[model samples]
Target: MPDPTPETSAGRSLLLVLHDVAPHTWPDYQPFVEAVDALGNIPITWLVVPDFHKRDSLAFAPGLRSMLDRRLQRGDELVLHGYYHADDSPPPRSVRDYFMRRIYTHEGEFYSLDQGVALERLHAGITLFQRFDWPLAGFVAPAWLMSEGTRQALRSLPLKYTSDPQYLYQLPQFTPISAPGLVCSARSAWRRGLSRLACELQAARLSQAPVIRLGLHPVDMRHGFTRRYWMCTLQQLLAQGRTPMTKSAWLSTRQAG
Candidate 1:
C-alpha cells in the first residue's frame, strides 16, 4: 500500500475521538473534555450509544442531551456508535470466534450481526439521534468491529463515513482514507503497558501521515497514566505541526482539497 503521508502542514491533522459516550458515561468525560479544551480549541468526535448495553437509554437523560447540544455548538460531532453496544448474538461456533467476539470484546454489537439486524440497529440508533436532533455523519461499530453484513447495511444509509482502527471509509461510496488510529487500553496493568507502548511506537511510525487518529474511551480518561499520556501525546503532535479537528471536519477538508 502507498503511504498517505503529506509533505506540508496544511494537509496534516489530528482526529480526536471519544468513544462509548452514553448517559452513564457522560460524567467521566467532563474532566477530560475540560483538559483538552484547556490545551486549545480541539473538536471532539463523540461516539454516542443510543441504549448502552441495553440497560440505559439516552431518552431518560435530559442533562446528557443538553450537554451534547452544547458540544455540537462548540464544533464537536455526534456519531451513532451502536444501538445496545453489547454482543447479543448466538453463541460463537468456533473458539477463535468466541475469543475474538466474546473474550477480546464483549461490546461487539455489530460484530456478527447479519444485514437485517445491522440495519435494524442502525435505524434504531438513527431514530434516537433524530429524537435529540443530533446530526450524524458516521456510524462506528462498537469496538470498531463491523461484520461484512454491517458493511452492507451501512451502504443503504446516506452517512458520510465510518472508521475502524485502520482506514476511514467514505460512506455510500466507501472510498477509503488511510488513517490508522492510536488507541489506549485501560483494562489491566499489562494491557495498559502494552497499549501505551504500541501507541507510542505507532505515533513515531506515522510521524508524517496526513492524518493521525486518537481514539479515547471514558475509562481511558478516568485513568491517571492514560490521561497524561494522551495529553502529552497531543501536545507533541501539535508541536510537530498537526492541527486537531473532529473526524467529520477532517473529512470535509480532505474532500474539499
Candidate 2:
C-alpha cells in the first residue's frame, strides 16, 4: 500500500508506545511513566500484557490496575498485548523461527498459534478487559510477531487495530500506516550499543515518514545508556517537529481520511 501523507502540515505525528506493561514489570516501568509525565504527560499507548509470562496476571494486581486506571483517566491508552506473553510452543525449526525465538528471547506468543488458538486467546484478553471495564484500543502481539493463522483470526475479531514492527494496521478496512518503530535492546552492553546505533539510524531514516513510532520496553529504561538514548531520540524527533499522538487518535485520522 502507498504510504499515507502526513496529517498536519507542521510535522509528522509521533506514536509513543510502552510495551509489556504488567504488574510484575511496573517497578521497572514506573520510571519511564514518571519521565513521560514530567514531559507534559505525552500520550502513550500502553501495550498491557493481560497475563505476563503466565506468572503475573492482572487479576492479582489491583494496585497496578489502579495506577493504570489513573493513567487512562489522564488520556493514556490501554491495549491488549497478549494473553500470556510467553512462548509455549515447540522449539523453532526454521531459520526465521530460530532467529525470532533465540534472538528475540522467546516471547512470541502469537508466532506459532493456529487460528482457533489465536481467537481463543484474543477472547480471553477481551474478557479480562471487559471484567475491568477498561477501554481496550486493540491487540498487539508480543514482540510484534503474528502467524498467518493469527492474522486470519484477527480479521474476524472485533479489534480496532494491530501493529507489526513496521506498520500500524486499522482493522476491518486494514488500512496500514507506515510507522517504523525505534526501540532499545538492553540485554547486554554489546546489544545495547548496537541497539542504540540502530535506533538512531532508524529514527533518522524514518524522520520524514508521515508517522513515527517509538516503542519502549521496561528493560529499555533499566539501563543508563539505553534510557539516555531514548531521551535523546525523543528530543531529536520533537525538535524535528514531530507531535506526540496516541495510537487511537492516529487511527481515527486514518479512518477519517
Worst 10 residues of 1 by lDDT: 1-10
lDDT string, candidate 2, 96-198, tens digits: 8899888866899999999999999999999999999898868999988899888888899889888888877877555676667887778899999999889
Model 1 TM-score, all chains together: 0.94
Show the lowest summed lDDT stretch of 10 residues, model 2: 2-11
| TM-scores, one per candidate | 0.94, 0.92
Give per-residue CA lDDT, model 1, range 1-257, as digits (tens): 34543334357899888999999898888887888899878888999998898788889989999999999999999999989999999999999889988789988889899999999989888888887899988999998898989999999997889888988888886777788889988988788899999999999999988889899998887788898898899889999988889888888787766
Every candidate's CA RMSD: 2.1, 2.2
**lDDT value, residue 125 of candidate 1:** 84
lDDT of all predictions? 0.87, 0.84
Considering every candidate listed, which one attains the maximal TM-score? 1
